[model samples]
Target: MSINKTNRSSLRYQSIKNDGYIMERLEELAKQNPVEGFWKCYGRIRNSGTIVNHKKLHRLYKKMGLPLRRKIKKRLPARVKEPLAVPAYFTQTWSIDFYE
Candidate 1:
């Protein structure tokens, strides 16, 4: 068995593979829904049969300059107060006196 050196021509640097279709799909979805973020995009692509890494997706998302919409807090409307109903009969209404 003899030691052999690897050829220099085969040594080439390749750039990271980025699918244009995925980028386009993400761009379309991002435009359609600007408020949603990584997880949402991840789910959308995953459901659409495209599995992507979260980090890569986020990196690309930032690279594409997609802005996440601010979340607005949902508040319950103030309830309207109703007047207390008066008892029809004196016996029907029992009052309790408390000395606190």
Candidate 2:
């Protein structure tokens, strides 16, 4: 291995910090607002004075499986077909056009 001994030793001794606090906060927000997406949750956390980076928050959010479900648009009902009535007289339907 061509790696520096000091760098390898530091990497071996590095400890990972617990992110439980942020995860709990995110889960709480999700429970309170199930319809809102990640950005809304991020905004709420930011407003509460937590300065978490968006990318980190997103990663944590994904890790916790908190993605919002996409809503499907409702299909419009089919329009009723109506038969057009023919005028018996020529003046039965009058149209006026104004030129500007």
Candidate 3:
């Protein structure tokens, strides 16, 4: 999900200008109080009626060389296959394939 680029630019700069100090302070608080998720921190700031744009915020994070923590993808556990013994020292062997 994403906001339109024009909308983001319009809102982001306006938000920065209107609440630059608050945005900066939020950054400081994020540093000092280190939240587990950066997006969550952004949400907190958004709740403050500030105009901070996600694209701009992300751009700054990129500029500062900060890594965004990606959520680990959940995977189903692998199914365990039972071992089978085949008899074929010198004898002919037959194999079969079945479709489900």
Candidate 4:
């Protein structure tokens, strides 16, 4: 089966319209919840009575560049290297042994 050019163009137009509406909704959700990730946005949309497929939603989510930035872990300051303290006399150190 083959589709004529007009029909193909019409279908494309309809798809574009639908995509535009979904994109707008996604953008609005993103704006309202800037820190929320894609799944949260998808859940909000789903809870709003819109039955969008997760795959499609993910595609649009990625297409709109709406992925949340990952938080970086804070690094602790470097410690000063110090020489290990050694007992001058063997009697100064104590050793413990454990037995089961």
Using TM-score, give the best candidate's number: 2
Best by lDDT: 2
TM-score of each: 0.54, 0.65, 0.42, 0.57
Report the candidate with higher lDDT, 1 versus 4. Answer: 4
Stretches off by above 4 angstroms in model 1 are 1-3, 7-16, 69-100
- lDDT for position 18 in model 1: 64
Candidate 2 clashing pairs?
none
lDDT per prediction?
Answer: 0.82, 0.91, 0.64, 0.87
TM-score of 3: 0.42
lDDT for position 4 in model 2: 57
lDDT of 1 by residue, 1-100 (tens): 2245666655667688967878898898988887788678879998999878878888887788885867899999999999998999888988899998
Query: Per-residue lDDT for 1-100 in model 3, tens only?
Result: 2555355445654432444565575567568666445677667778877667887776665555454567799999999998886677846667699999
Better of 1 and 4 by TM-score: 4
lDDT string for model 4 (4-98, tens) is: 53554445544333688789999999999898999998999899998889999999999989997889999999999999889999999989999
Deviation from native of the Cα of residue 18 in model 1, angstroms: 2.7
Ranking of candidates on TM-score, top first: 2, 4, 1, 3
Question: What lDDT tens digits, residue by residue, belong to model 2 across residues 1-100?
Answer: 3355455555666689678989999999999999899999999999999889999999999999999788899999999999998899998997999999
